[model samples]
Target: MAMEASMVKAVIFDKDGTLFDFTATWGPWTADLLRDLADDAAHADRLARAVGFDLSTCRFDPASPVIAGTPGDSARALEAALPGMTLDAIVRILIERSRDVVPAPAVPLAPLLSELTDRGLALAVVTNDAEGPALEQLDGHAHHFAFIAGCDSGHGAKPDPDPLLAAARALGHAAEDCIMVGDSLHDIRAAHAAGMRALGVLTGPATELPGAEAVLPDIGHLPRWLDATT
Candidate 1:
């Protein structure tokens, strides 16, 4: 059953596919990174396969670890194709390159976030991306979030309840008083493990994520859902 919006004191969002359009934001970057790392067409293909990316379409597979995995996970996949690169070096490269990729917001973030804030709901971001890049994507809208956590924030990544629980603690809300909004099974699973209500968005490839209280097209629809439920 869907939790009542009146009962929700805070909302924790996932960065990549939840707040931003995943393919529009990351597809070009992935294509460029793969090309930069590979020595030739064959090597590029190998790297794409390793990371579950489709070179022809430059889009990630729905099941790709890169969809919800950490930068370290992406580095590991790249390492399989670029054996000469150290893991730390690969991670650094990915992070540095990510800093330059312009993010495509799933909606007009500032207005939507402001509307939620006006409703007296605290907001936060919990992402598999590093804190720096996550903040970079948030940019002008960073103030909307009361808390922002990344995989490297030391609370551990999704599928573990630490980050979600930490967000609730920071927001001064109980787990049950917060709603976790994301676009992957990892996010829903983590929210469930943390005892928060899970809401899924289709800004990513996911269509039917398990354990979600409700699924909507994107964050743009969240305000209406909240109003209707209340």
Candidate 2:
């Protein structure tokens, strides 16, 4: 059953695949990073496997830590692959690369967010990406978000509920008064754990998340879904 939009006072979005097209936004960057870190084909393959990416396809496994893991998690994976590199150094590299990425929004964001705000719903972004890059990705749209938390924001990361709960608290809404929209199981699971409604989107590799109240083609359809449900 669709959740009643009337009951939702806030909307929390997962960045990366939720707000932006995961492949379009991150595929090239991942490929480039792997190449820069590896000295040879054999080494590149090792790094790819360590991060759960397939070099041949340049696609990440749905279970890949890179898909939903925090920068520290990714650094750990990279550290395993490159024994000489320290975790902090790996983290710095990832953060630097991330800031340079140009996000490809799943839909035009400003107008859509405006519509939601006009409806009196508070908005936020809770992402596993580092806070710096997440903010850079939002750019002009950053002002629309009432709260923005990243892995480094000290709220912890999803599929833990700390960040989601923090976002709700920041917005002055109870967990049940918020909806979390994302394109991964981590996002859905976090919402469930946080006592918020979960709405999944297919802009990423995830297609059939088990606990999503609705699986959408993309966030572009969210307004209509909200209207119909409310």
TM of each candidate vs. truth: 0.96, 0.95
lDDT string for model 2 (146-190, tens) is: 999999999999999999999999999999899999989899889
lDDT of each: 0.91, 0.90
Indicate the residue-level lDDT of 189 in model 1.
88
- Model 1: CA > 4 A from native: 1-6
Alpha-carbon RMSD, each predicted model? 1.5, 1.8
TM-score of 1: 0.96
- Please give, for residues 101-211, the per-residue lDDT of candidate 1 as tens digits: 989999989899999999999999999999988898899999999999999998999979899999999999999999999999999989988889999999986777877
Model 2 TM-score on a 0 to 1 scale: 0.95
**Best candidate (score: lDDT):** 1
The count of backbone overlaps in candidate 1 is: 0
